[model samples]
Target: MDKEFTPRIAAILCQWCSYTGADLAGTSRLQYPTSIIAMKVMCSSRVDPVLLLKAYLSGSDGVLLGGCHPGDCHYEVGNYHTRRRFAILKAVFDTLGLESARLKLSWISASEGPKFAQVANDYTEEIKKMGENPSKKKMFL
Candidate 1:
């Protein structure tokens, strides 16, 4: 019997904003897919690009990066750094023949619980349409 396909998502969230937003989503009883696994980071800028690549290569169908809005990062320019890095990461994925759409970045404040839930649901659906990550079948040495 063939097992049903379910997209796996890795969410790297900023502790001050996105992670707190996710917590609010939970406390507010917002419903989202269980396919997402979230990790909290001190800042979005602290998330290495390699970690995002590794998540996809390791079988995550999609990766979600959430951070403070522009000009609102607690660390002053952290989100700016994240924006630049994400742009480069997308370019690298495209050059490698990977679908860059599998990666997403969103600005969510701690007060935006509804937005968090909406993003999660929407991104989950998008990933479902994209199917599984092709790299999952490849052997990387």
Candidate 2:
């Protein structure tokens, strides 16, 4: 474990809120880890469990799913759907011998730039302490 390990995170953000919040974090010059690679989708519910699995299998040490808060989604109940789906995804991860801690679900409003940055930093540190994803090594086999 002496080798340098930088955790790679796949962040899927809702365009209406989470993405905007992340963008605002950047515009505000907030400091967060560079390990996250964010992808914006129309809504949090649009993210499929398969997509999250793919990210993990493809060498991502962690996956962060960000969406609007419940009752505040632009698409009414989209965030609710996301919350349910995320739970199922976590179960699937656990069944597959993957650490469910590697997956994070966060609700961030468009105005919560500081919160987004803090989440990013915290999640990044957690992943660093967790080390690399074991699934990554198995992917090549």
Expressed as tens digits, the lDDT of each residue in 1-141 for candidate 1 is 114777889999999999999999999999988977899999999998889988988888999999999999999999999999999999998998879999999999999999999999999888888888888888862
As a whole number from 0 to 100, the lDDT of residue 138 in candidate 2 is 88
Write candidate 2's Cα lDDT for 16-100 as tens digits.
Answer: 9999999999999999889889999999999997898788778789999999999999999999998988899899878977788
Each model's TM-score? 0.94, 0.93
Lowest-lDDT window of 10 residues in candidate 2? 132-141
Please give the clash total of every predicted structure, in order: 0, 0
Runs of candidate 1 exceeding 4 Å displacement: 1-3
Per-residue error at 83 for model 1, in Å? 0.5
Error of 1 at 20 (Å): 0.5
What lDDT is reached at residue 33 by model 2?
88
